[model samples]
Target: MTHATTTDGVRIAYQLQGQGAPLVLLAGQANNHHWWDQVRADFHPARSTLTLDYRGTGDSDKPDAPYSTELFAEDVIAVLDRLGIDRADVYGTSMGGRVAQQLAARHPHRVAALVLGCTSPGGPHGVERSNDVRKALAQPRPEAARQALLELMYTPRWLDSHPGPHHTLGDPGMPAHARRHHLAASNRHDAWELLPDIAAPTLVIHGADDLLNPAANAPLLADRIPGARLELIPQARHAYFEEFRALAGPLVLDFLTTAPSRP
Candidate 1:
């Protein structure tokens, strides 16, 4: 366990695993570092991996204010400064992708490569949800919010096979109020116009059946970012990492380890 103080005074909780080049992973919206547990094993132990819980989501301090994607980027910069890491490969999933994009645009020197998963540009047909789904997520009831999350994010097969909805009242023991706030934070995020400025070796991965963020988003991102490659996993859902942890982990490890970094 480690802590880093952002410029805004929020103490971010993080852990470092492995020992080669540093890799910073920004988790999805409403999630903590545990989200990366399954994928961590795929990396070479010689490489360093940094996974952190964003404010209001995990062990970090949750302040009462409107959270934006920029703040999340700042949090990443703070971690880098605190750890004395000058450069790193960055990965973000879902809402975290918004932060990763902002980080590359705003601080290109610190980023060696970028990987975006299950995310979109927030353009037309992106991860924007329907009014009913949005309303359900905002509901104070845990069950309602959990159901909303499952419906908007997961595919039918994933829900049937996983233990998500069965224990929706408090699936991971996180409180209803916290989940609601986290959901709100995810909903408030949008960054469609900033893709062009990301100047790094980039990889965009998405699932074919991501209803929340359509698979079409992968092409849009690749088209905008010069030389960015898009890889789509057929029949996978929004939570593809969880649904196919074994497959997803290795793919990410291969990309991060194989990509050549500029000197």
Candidate 2:
């Protein structure tokens, strides 16, 4: 584990493994470095992967402060600068995808390629989650929410084998205030106007049945971003990156590993 100090004095924690081209894995809202635990091995040896804990998650400082995708993006820049990596391929899921939007739009020179999963450009232009999906995600009790999340994330077939939800599901295990901050930041993320600013080759991939972010948003993103590609995993849900990694992993790996960097 290594720590990088952001300009704001927050100590961002990150883990780097393997060797080859750098690939930064950004976790969803309220999640930490462990977000990539399931699929990290799939990309092993083929690429060097880095995963970081966002503020208020894992080993990073969880101060009582407001958070935004823009700030989260800057924190990633701090980590990259600390490691002297000029540019890297980035894969971001859920809220991390929101931050990735900010990163690639705000710091185009730092990203070689980009992959966004199960997330959307927030605000008025973005599609909102269904009431049923919201109810499933918010069950009053944490345990109930976790249970509901499992159903919302994984298909019944996956649930037959995988009994429990990941610890990093929903707001993760963060303070109530920090969890609120994460949701707020994710809610406010409006990359609709900023989408066209991204210069890196981008892939917008999602689950066909993602009620949380909704698969319908994928086309909007792919259409807005110049030269971006769209891919949908059939019958998958919000957490397809985790539940359908076999398909999602290779698709993302191939795009990032082969896309030409900025000249």
lDDT of 1 by residue, 42-85 (tens): 66564678988887756777776667777888888888899899
Which residue pairs show backbone clashes in model 2?
Answer: none
All candidates' TM-scores? 0.84, 0.96
Stretches off by above 4 angstroms in model 2 are 170-172
Per-residue error for 26 in candidate 2, Å, reads: 0.7
- Candidate 1 residues lying further than 4 Å off, grouped into runs, are 123-127, 130-141, 144-148, 151-185
State model 2's lDDT: 0.88
Among all candidates shown, the one with the greatest TM-score: 2
lDDT of 2 by residue, 1-263 (tens): 68999999999999999988889999888888877888898888589999899999898888899999999999999999999999999999889899999999999999999999988988898899889878877678987887777777788898899875474474346888888898899998999999999999999999999887888889989999999999999999988988898899999988887787674
